[model samples]
Target: MMLLPEGSFDFALQDVLNRNDHFQSVTEGDACVGKVASLLLYVEPVMADSGCLQVLQRFVSDETLQAVAIVDDKHNAVGIIDRGKISDIFLRPFSRDLLGKKAISEIMDKQPIVVDIKTGIDDVARIIIDSGVRHMVNGFIIHDRGVYVGMATGLSLLKEITHRKQRELFIMAHYDLLTGLPNRLLFKDRLLQACQNAKRLGHLLALIFVDVDRFKAINDSMGHAFGDKLLQNIASRLAASVRQSDTVARLGGDEFVIVLQNVKSSQDVCGIVGDIAEQLRQPIPIYEREIHVTTSMGIALYQDYQDSAEELVRKADIAMYEVKQRGRNGYLLYAPDMEQQDDIRMSLETQLRMAIDGGELSLYYQPQVDLKQNCMIGVEALLRWNHPNLGSISPAVFIPIAEETGLIIPIGEWALKQAVQQHLEWIAQGLPPLRVAVNISAVQFQADGFADKVRRIVADSGIDPAYLELELTESGVMSRAELAIKTLTDLRALGVKLAIDDFGTGYSSLSYLRRFPIDRIKIDQSFVRDIHNTPANEAIVKAIIALGDSLGLEMLAEGVENQQELAWIMSHHCREAQGYHFAKALSPADLRSWYAQSIVIKCP
Candidate 1:
């Protein structure tokens, strides 16, 4: 077999072959065979001793005669010649006269790249790039079982490879690797285009920002691989929930942006947002367990906002953060006033940091009374911040900010140390020993070496560990139940009492609750506030009391504001109660004075 450059073929013979039914049918087996056979020329090869002048004459006669094959007497391919080498020799002064009349084989390329006729177009492209030849004047030879078929051009193969590379580059730039959804770059481009269209057509467009709530917690607890799979699942659901005209894009890590074009009104946007939220809320099965997640969506209307695409997205982001602040699993529309509220929150966050350092934060104690004995037995330490300018700031306002900023870890530690030290001081003053319960933030509880830190603080405080009670919320304990069990057990070994606060608010598995080494459970105030009027609250409170009794753990009801509620709690066998019905949270000095003067004194 021999490689030969592309050459002009006899026009009459090519027409005859084109008209032949056999040739056309034979080419139908594999449509992708873009090889030398498809452009073959039937020109016969000259012998090694053939006149170079004659070959040059033939090349001059045929404009397409770029190269020709050389063969032995037995019809075996040996070498090839191209128009380039012939022109190089002839163009030099006196060189053509010296070498043009010699054998064409003298100037022929003896070794050339060859491939099978059935080789894929892709493989042929790779061969063209790998070969050092700038132009295959003598094109690559295609063979079938050692028989020469035809020649293939380097230009054609390179064009196909360039086209394929362009396509791949496009996909890489526009789509996310993990979710296969449009990435932020493409989303922004599409959002800009959609805004332009909406403005031109006088239609409403809504840009909805969807953020998965507590996704970092999920990712940290379940591992990133599972988190990636969860994102993919979420992307698919979002895609299925929207129309083909709408664009859903992943803005990296638990955040997706959707552009709803041609929306009728805010109501239409609301309906779509609701559907998307519901779709995301559906349980996604991961690693044999169903993982549940909810999305907080923020919608910004194009005409209503009258802003640039980037600004609209920013507004939507602000709204999404507002949803997160109001307790996630819902959607909110962007309002002008929300930005002001955000500024206030930022100011509060700044002031809070200063408060922590300036000793403006103090612990207020709320008495937890032993209702059965009609006496106070313990006090829950609640944190309070009094800013120099803003006066008393509610924990409900600053606590979430602290948690988000990770200041909760230090704040929690301070609260625990202060409560323990205060308890020790009371003991030194000859007062009865009482348990001092301090609420532990989830961040502080899950922190590395937290149990060890608590142990160190307790040892340093010189207070009996039994008097230092740590109150962990139900969601905090159940987030990582197995890990919580280990941590709780370690704290239990330190001799500090452990209790689950805001018990009925979260979904805590009973089996894990049993496994946790808890000394008591505090009924959340929401259930305890209207226990007399709301049958559901009454039943839940009763059930929790019974559950505590069955598990040999004490039950305490919070938010007891009147005799009726206290009577109802005591009637249901609740051992302890805490709320304004007895006394509100008081300063350390005021609490000491109140406890001294109070007629209700109980001993265990």
Candidate 2:
């Protein structure tokens, strides 16, 4: 309905406007997000008996008024007047003059779509759509207890619904569904915000990267359902471990991140980290099982805003990997040297690529002796690298890099070829035949057609496969025992002698020992280092020797560097041993001389 004279409608408007504050309160709260009252606009209502000129004057005074309510003497809503219709009517030549004096009810909509203020915005929107799109031009009257209260426009309704949908979409995109924590996208955003806050407040920001240790193993063994429950439990504990100002986020899988703002010092971070570690150490009950998990955390601090959010996260990730490398279940602060070490590792990996082609790599022979016979029985071939610029690089440092880079396969092939050729040369020189042991890395062993490659190498060498011994780490074979079993069987079929290297240091299980096809168990150096004094080492060595005896396999003690260590293995009935005490890894010439001397001593 058209508006009445300002003075005439003022009385009705005042009566309805008195309830506007209550309507405002309902619209602003969370519970009323989709309620019709949220879209209510309090426009002065016109008296039903007023003239069209009075409505015209009221529209002129309030330029933003989209529509007006027509109410009766009791303030009951009767009809609605749209601004568009009135403007159209009055704009036609002298139509306003002819119709402006008529009663506003004569031209107004007698039955407008009036919705109760309590109705949902969706319901009212549906009503508008079903009634016709024309109803949106003038909107509709909103009332309470049959009394006209306000008008709700189509524009405001659309915006409110759109805003709510956007909020829902935002939550879905930014949060992890399972853990209900910020995912990587949102974590980066929060980290940037935290960094800004820290910079503004002139305080330190600590970025912590957390990785659940051996999570894949647990996930594979316990089933995905149990793994999911464990992750949720961990998420809850991690959230509880921090303050309200801090943010804990899951970067997917078992990786989580945390941002701590206003950190006072490294000690403050240490205390928080210690608490987190302790919290994670507690057993989590899932599926009637008390599951235990340990985390490796790496913390990178922004003291002077030197690192961006991304750089901070990267540095923390690098530090976390360091913890994994050293051993799992601990934390490491991001040190400058750690980054430097990472750079060096990357550089070494690049250099190793050229190493095989550049002839920088070679093999050295360390003699394995028969302790009782006091004579050499075999030699273990170790890979050595002499970089053109860097004098010598330990296999301990470069082998892992090669494994990670997939460079180990070619390098391993090279070593196998060289060792076999060297053995053939020794035989050609009329030296006594001895088993030449060459170590095989896990990646090179598990590679497709590995056995076939070994067969090809053995055939090409024209040397007896009996003289070639392949030394595999205990953990390397035991990690995937079934695959290893098949591979070992294939190698055994080729008549190559097999030995388990570094025994008693990794998955030392009797089950795999019975299942695997062959030969010797080499006691790791750690067990042999102080075997006479350390009961644990002595016990481990004795157990290995006994296990080898039971399996009808030879037992060789590695790292026998002293008379006491050598005497201890000999007393334990270990027949073979190798270490610096016997002779260091030597060149072919030195090994030939040492072999001749060893034969003379044994014969004498």
Candidate 3:
């Protein structure tokens, strides 16, 4: 047999055959090639009038000749006859004798299954199977550029199809479909290999677990498609931020794992982590909007932990969770003691869940006085929890846990209901009409139907909405500024007053402050605490006061513990004050008694 395109034929044929060796035979349901040009077998044909039987016998005798391509005078493929078709004719007793004298074209198939060279093997196989052709006497003809290139056997197309499927399966198992990064399985495998390398070299290796902060909130507010796009964008940024030697992988759902090999020192790890965090801090464009996201990272050192890859990953996860607990958008190095801290927090959370129903939670009220009148104008309600096992857990500790665990919604509601009931009791007892302010958490404030819930609670308590004031921290309001404004507007429509509780402590935009339907600004206790000693504190307080005054809003000072701070507050014409200088937060009954005592002293 002669190969086509003469000199180039053998090398190309050998290469195709070598690559095809790795492919298994095509099984049922496999994708097969419609036409394979590389497997084409071109055979010289015998003349029709010249003793075709002798030529056919010679073709059958040749071991490599499976089929013979019969061409017209112009060398174009006109018909084909294979060993199987010739065997069928000779098997019949009288058939070969009667037709032996006829031309070879008369015995050859007039029309065979002709297909394009580029068509898929599965389609070719289906067409052949559907045609009820029990055996392929003449294999399919392959054409490229509308010219006959060669013919392809059923077996060759099947082998190539199986090979492609195996390659696809391998890729799907190792890589994340959306981000094209290594999945957890691949990451863990690489991490194990990296750990071995680090141990042998006596070097440090760092594994970082990253979680995108507030991702669920963004996903819920926007559609999941948008969330997916956001994650993809974040994946690209994370990949670009790390060293090429490091492996960045997606650990599913807004979480990523990075393995840094051959680390020299902790400082090197810190620099890399900082760069990754800074990269994520930039705004990402998605769906015609710029969505900003921050990442919380936890780093575990292989040299320090000396654990298995799975254990190291678990430690890194714990550290990342710690950063989230510490208010997110930060990183923490793993320490063994953090495990104990986690256990303690878990215990406290369990106890706090039962605190409310167990009758261990109560409110303490601190009076806010009008300095000019020397009388209490309002009271701020604070929560206190006395645990059965642990006595008197501080609000600073438990409040945050409640917020994190979503127990704040119920706890905050309880506080609001209790405060309103107490104030109503005082009013019924013939006390002066005084407002009661309650601090609101960001989670509770942004919860669905929060404003409606507040309205219902105030209505059920039968207290005038004017006497109920809700305090929101600057950070809480500004986190979702537009939503805060809408919620605040709804609450104000119910006649309840709103105040920025810890003013000047967050990135509060002045534009948003002016737009919010706020009634007052309470200078944060941090600023008011050191006003007498710290010049910067005094300046900040004065500026806040002046800003509040210019906006025609009232200013209240908190944590004023002495006459010096009180005098400074009043000298600056501040409207209200709340601190231990006048009185500490007391129980409802003690507050009533303190209110009854008229203590008026002139400031010298």
Candidate 4:
């Protein structure tokens, strides 16, 4: 084998002109090469009858020509001669002298890689790769309708493939596939640019964060295809609601963002938001049904906030969460107080992560008394957190945060296990076994394998499952009614009692309520709070108790604080009650002592 000379081929002006013309005629701007014709090089072909020395002379004259096609008298491609083979034949001692007068056909490769001009680049590439690396070095002959035209190099093929991959990566990185909108990465870049422009021009810029309200519920109910179509439709509306100079981007899943440039004032921002709300709220036809949609919008103005791009985005997100907290389907401007509140919540979230392992969490028992018998019948286990630095925190303050961050799943499980162990401990203390109610968070109740987890806890604790009552909120069970029914049925099979806590507070369907395998309903504290004075409160309480009676479910009133409230509940024939009227939630030892002294009738 002989190595061909490096840089032996000349890159002439004629060849450059030919390449430019071929590119302009056959290829579009920056797109992947579509056909072999797109990469054609105007390397002239040699006649088969030409002298071998003539071919050797032609090769020596141009170093850039890697291969030359051998054509018949009719100008159809017949064969090929690569530089290396021709050079090898002549480099031998006195070989050129002997073969110089011989016909070029004597040395031309009969089996060359030949392809049609219309052949796809990818197919040509595969053929070249499958044949051998020598074909790439020698190049392939391309013809249009069996007539020799030009050739294509492996280098050009590789370049086009690389460009295609890069284009694909760019789209994946900067755009959402589902909505064809700019994604988070592109959104951040545009936001930074907008902030710089606003600062330099002394103009206002607003960053708006938009989140679809209860999108998960809708998605779960209507299927993911419907959800994806909904998001795409929302994206179009959002883009249309803003200026072309501004940007609309999807930050993933039901959350989108907009960058508004050259804002006149907060009033202008308000008007734009109002229009967006109106457009988004219009009913979307999905699955042959019209579905109403709503979004929560939070806006942060650059001039008003005077912060970095990241801080502006953070402020907008905080304001959006505020809208969700108050109730969705509205927008709000970022206020300084909201920042303080967000900061406190962030700090608390950090602390709560460590609270479980740091021994900062404990259960306080609240006694439930049977008003008819005037005796302690059961107790609800309440989770209490005492921060090492901040002292005791109310469940109302931390429970929602827990649910949002998904910490409630583990926390709720721990609470259930602790309640079960406490019941066992009380039995060991020579006290009669009483039903222990554990409040379950909605996040925990809807979690996968929740019934299995409860079964394991009860089985491992060596306690009777009937004495372990799991209290679920009406909203928790009603959110996913079918799943809730299945889970409740499984737990009931385990022989554990179930109750709907804060019963009247949530939107529970009467149909769903009748289907749920619950043993009791705890009247929410709100209705029981002012039952003695407020007629509306009294009416709600009466209605809940009557509903419970009609369903053959035991009713327990919460927050029975005074004698008048207790009198009203007792006269209404509600059998059970629990609140400050008896005693506040007490520690293990305190509750044990309080129960012994407070019991009017002792259990057998």
Candidate 5:
């Protein structure tokens, strides 16, 4: 193929559509044998006698002599022609005689000093001047491998070259400068393109959406210079993981996208996903720490032919959420069932926000009894939501939702204040002051101004700080030990008690107990509920009680139902207890009334 090298400067359109240095195929010679198709006013040959002189009246009137160039089957530009030449020789003088006597090929110049397909306008001008040809025939031909494919008048080719150059500039404007990867704008374009490709392939294509986990934290701690370097490193690694046929893009920030093409089956995807997960699992060292933050990848697979780009991205996002739900550090494949769950969760989240705002929620205290006395000494503040229509909602379900949506911070605050208020009221009425142990979620503790909020609530409720206890799960504190201690220490300084709720069930290290200011440990209900039958439960309960004693932390046996379990707990010096073995979570008024008349209820 030969390119009109110097003439390329003539039009941006050529630059826009054509970039390869390839030109129309041509042999040696500054002069090429221009073809009749481009030079002659040639239409689809009418298949009449060769003597018919065909004319294009429309082109003849519009274009100039400079606009015409022609090439042969070998891509050789045999000669050049222009519109004016066609009109002069055939249409103006001897018009009728020429029309009947000869075809365009017969009259058109057989050889003129011509422009090679590769000849620049600078050189071609030299040829026209050298040949002293008065006029050029119709237009220029652009050929691929010696074949006649297109005609480009010098003017049209010049215009095309100009237009194409401008479009290239447009691409440079929008595309990412580094890695030559698409920035957000181009990524969206490619995402759309990928969706179309997936539809055409009759196979699946999955978008593996990845956000380098905690990339900002690393970026913040390590400095921006290092962050940029790390990003480059990551981009390289990620790009290497996919096929040459696929696209790996940085969607700005730490987020990236992988466009998987021509996927054979879901397992092929699963294997790739697992490999990616493992590759990311390896710690990326920055500075001193072998900082390992695993990805939460969401795959939006092409499951149906009807899906669009927006739907695919949304599905991938939804799948990423499921990975987060499964406790992060992994991936979730997009599924139809997950969409249903997504809808339900969104609905529940909406209703839950309303529940907090409209004051449709409250704390229900369940009495914690002394296993030996069979009498209540303290109560765990079990949160209950009277949903007005849905009735009382369980903690098991919404506690998680609250934690996720951050609604637990406010709801928990309300519960703490209400519980304290009720406990204070019991004391003022000459009833025994029950220690109010309110369950504290990780979200509540990690909240901004948590210590301040708790202090204010205790003060406002007029409850003795000593009679208040904050109960956190052992697992929760263990996960964020430093932050938990800072939060826990501030609360403990206010003179309220603190306990690890649901202990021995979570895999809490022994070291966790020494890290924070905890006053008590409550054996999880699972152990107590089955202590009679499972020797493992009995042994675990005893060891926990013993460990609590050794640590100088008070012990409570939760779910000490029936006489055998009660007997076992009391015998082990388990001092505080609560479960269905006592009363289920109840309103403060009900508990007060029950305490006023109830006998020494023995476990049966």
Candidate 6:
């Protein structure tokens, strides 16, 4: 608690503190605030006994309150023992005579800085902070009725300021910084408190974590800061929309948490949650942009699966993820069955982990063909998990769960290694050294040493660095630019290729694509799924291909389910395509056979 000089990061502390738009206020030579018309009458007992020392003792004792003693024979107040003087005097030495002190005139301070009652707390806080004093003295200095009122200290004001700042900072930390409301941190704290309360009161504390579905689309179409301000504006409305006791927190990105306190039944959680969903159904205007987002809420209550806050948060987070799985804009209360869903998904995650350990996980390549040249230019390495009991689990079910649970690190690594090795084998067999593209999840990409992992894998596999390819989502690229740049640079250095996967469905700033060291972009399947039917889909697809073409980056079409889709892709001059049309991710041996047994395009 002590801001000791040794452990201090003096100047750095300011950056830790949030700045205000307006400056703080100040009032000089203000009257010492008093409760009574008569000031001296209050201090009469102290003056009669030990005037100056009594005031000094009282002032230093309470860091928050400030006071001064006026001393003189005629009570003309020749000098005063203000807070600073008293603090200094108290720090000097302890004395028994401090009690028997005569008139305050002997030890009172003559002049002291005082702020008026109208002075802003910010200005008052700054003075004491700048002065290095624990407290700032404030109030009416001269008595209106000749009776001196009590003084307020810088320490007290400072403590109050610091406490409030801590709360505000905590709000910014865990909650939405833009909204000035409870953030994820606050939600976590509240969830923890709820768990404790639930145990004590034997009541159910329901944790419903909500994510704004397609929120990124809104933010991407608009702007992020605007997205932030929109979040802030809606957060207050959301708070007002809910019950006074219920807690709503923005959990960063588009995710949010609502802790329903003292729930006796699932109905209680649902009824309020239904109302919360209704409130957010309307569109929010961000500048001239009318932005829209829907909520997918996952609900979990305390004492169900967890007795603690972290468990509650984890369960709620899991449930929230389920809501997204079931399709956004709906609420799914935490069901015991949901754990089954998590278990099945986690079983796959666990299996993926074990697969790596058991050597059951392998990577299969889908050749990326240059339809024009009719040659396999690159191969996208698709991950395959062959479980002992379950056989083959679908990536559709597990990939997301892996990404969410952060199991993708090891799994992605396994895939990366396999891809590099496969590319190396093709080259060793005198086959064309086509680029081997491996998918990188946002979590895996964000991980520290991800680039290094790729470097290590390429080196270990003895593959040409340029033949290794990394595929990422558009949003994935923008999430952490500095880190992404580092990752891409390292891979690009290895002569590895970096491709943006499912390109259109992200909050990508076109400027960022230029910023990132990306070499290719694969149009998402949804845009390509019915690109022929939907003008929007076709337009989006064409624009992306054009953008990639103009950037001189290779463009690949995903989810080419039919010949018509393939013909359209080929006509558009897309360099490559992958989906159910070419082949769903196949088995390693099957993939090799599919590539090898068929017509092998002769290299030039």
- The lDDT leader among the candidates is 4
Write candidate 3's Cα lDDT for 1-604 as tens digits.
Answer: 3334533423432333344322233223434322354455545554434355765677778976667666666445666677777777877898767877777788876666666767755566556665534324356776666556677664555455556556545556777877878898889899999998888888899999999987766776577999999999999998988778899999899899999999889888989899989999888999887867888999999995469999999899889878877888899999998898778888899988989799999999999988887778899999999887889889978887888788998999999999999998998887777889999998888787999999899778888999999999997888778888899999999999999998898879889888999998999889988688899999999999989987889889999999999998999999799999988999999988887774843222
Per-residue CA lDDT of model 2 for 91-168, tens digit only, reads 889987798779899888888999988997767766765676667678888999998889888667656655654555
- Predicted candidate 6 versus true structure: per-residue lDDT over 1-604, tens digit per residue: 5554532422433433446521121112235321112222233313523655556667657675445545344443334455565566556655436634565555655554344444555554455456543233432243334433444443444454555456545444554545656766667777677677778788877777777665554465346887787677667667886677878877777666777777778887788888888878766776765544568888876755345677667777778878866645688766667778876765666666666689877776776776777666777787777778878877787777666556777788777777777767766766667777788887777676777887777667677677777788876667556557777787787787788888888778777778788888888889998777788988998899889978889888888899888888888888778777766666556766666765646447
Stretches of candidate 6 exceeding 4 Å from the true structure: 1-207, 210-245, 248-296, 300-318, 324-339
Comparing 3 with 6 on TM-score, the higher-scoring candidate is: 3
| TM-score list, all predictions | 0.80, 0.64, 0.82, 0.69, 0.62, 0.60
- Angstrom error of the Cα, residue 195, model 5: value is 3.5
Q: Clashes in model 2: which pairs?
A: 1-80, 1-81
Displacement of residue 99 (Cα, Å) in model 5 is 66
The positional error of residue 324 in candidate 3, measured at the CA in angstroms, is 2.5
| Clash count of each predicted structure | 1, 2, 5, 7, 47, 28
List lDDT for all candidates, in order.
0.81, 0.84, 0.81, 0.85, 0.68, 0.66
Error of 1 at 42 (Å): 13
Q: Which stretches of candidate 5 lie over 4 Å from their true place?
A: 1-184, 209-258, 262-264, 271-297, 323-330, 505-507, 527-529, 535-543, 561-573, 601-604
- lDDT, candidate 3, residue 239? 90
Give the candidate order by descending TM-score: 3, 1, 4, 2, 5, 6
Error of 3 at 397 (Å): 1.8
lDDT comparison, 4 vs 5, better candidate = 4
Q: Which candidate achieves the best TM-score against the true structure?
A: 3
Instruction: Give Cα distance to truth, residue 582, candidate 4, Å.
Output: 5.5
Root-mean-square deviation of candidate 3? 7.8
> What's the true lDDT of residue 251 in model 2?
90
Writing each residue's lDDT as its tens digit, candidate 5 over 256-351 gives 778898888878887998898788777666656454457778898885868888888888878876776665678878888889878867877789
**Superposition error at 232 for model 6 (Å):** 12
